[model samples]
Target: MTPLHRVGSALAIAVALSLVTACTAPAPTPSPTPTIDDSAANTPPPTPAESVAPAGGSDPTCETIIPAATVEDFESLGWSAEQDDFRVGATIIDGGLQCVWADHAGPATDHVQIFGWAPIEQDAAYDAQDNLVGEGWVREDQPDGVYITENPETTISTDENGYGMTYLFGDGWVKVADTKQGLLLVVWGD
Candidate 1:
């Protein structure tokens, strides 16, 4: 072939080879997408602070309200007793004892609260129960007394961490207990 014909033939062969290589070449593999973790997002938010009533009534000593043996048991478990003015929700107990046992170094959920008062009139106790029911508490009448609680299934147990109010009302006495939060109120007298 002539020099020009040779060049033309070489160019045509090179172009054909390039086209075939491009059409037959394997495509590049794609990288994997990163995963987003959202495990913490599913957790429930912390409970908001409840409205507290103004401090009133007699502030009894923790030792007086909690028996010596119970106090010793709490001490043995590394828990301390705290006493303060008696109040429940937005109501103040005029002459009552507020006692708490918990580990001060631990979280606030680790606590047992108690409030006790005697000579509470039946009408006043019922009135208190009505007020609590108005505020979303559930009431159940027992054979000996009335039981009011924020969550009826949640009881005051030393072995469990619980949240909500548990109040027991007798003919002339009221006792309140809050396991998670250390506060209670007892209504006494007329």
Candidate 2:
């Protein structure tokens, strides 16, 4: 045989051997499927001794003021509750319960703050409505009281306004909700 033919034959044999080796190689073991622990999500919030009352209004615990289902819904959205004294417009009324739910890992504007004052006098409720109106908030009269809001229409999450503030004045209660990141606050008073 010619020298060139022998070299060509050797190259063909090497290529055939490589193909056979690759075909016989063992298949790699796949990583075990990861298990997610969702126990925290199912856990319920603590229950306090008594229901919340505005009289002398010692600041109510987060558990007392917010419902378990509400808190769970917020938690599902990666938000957690923080209880603190909150400011509404230009006033910080005493003896009110404030609960703010926010994604601590996210931006500062991603939060929902709710301030509720019960057993409020009529005069104070009117004063709060007036204060919000003076700050360019629109007022709508409800059968029980008034509903005042910075933006009357629903806000989109990407809107430049960033947040919306709403005040609900009822018979003996007043609630202020400052919401951003597309959160909705619905409060009912007894």
Error of 1 at 120 (Å): 2.3
Candidate 2, residue 99: CA error in Å? 1.8
Q: All predictions: root-mean-square deviation over Cα?
A: 17.2, 9.8
Clash total of candidate 2: 0
What is the per-residue lDDT of model 2 for residues 80-134, given as tens digits with 9 covering 90 to 100? 7676663457567666656766676766764454534444678877787788788
How far out, in Å, is residue 161 in model 2?
A: 15
Report the number of the highest-TM-score candidate: 2
Candidate 1 yields a Cα-based lDDT of 0.56
Candidate 1 Cα misplacement greater than 4 A, ranges: 1-60, 105-119, 152-164, 179-190
Candidate 2 regions off by >4 Å?
1-59, 76-78, 105-119, 152-163, 179-189
- Candidate 1: which pairs clash? none
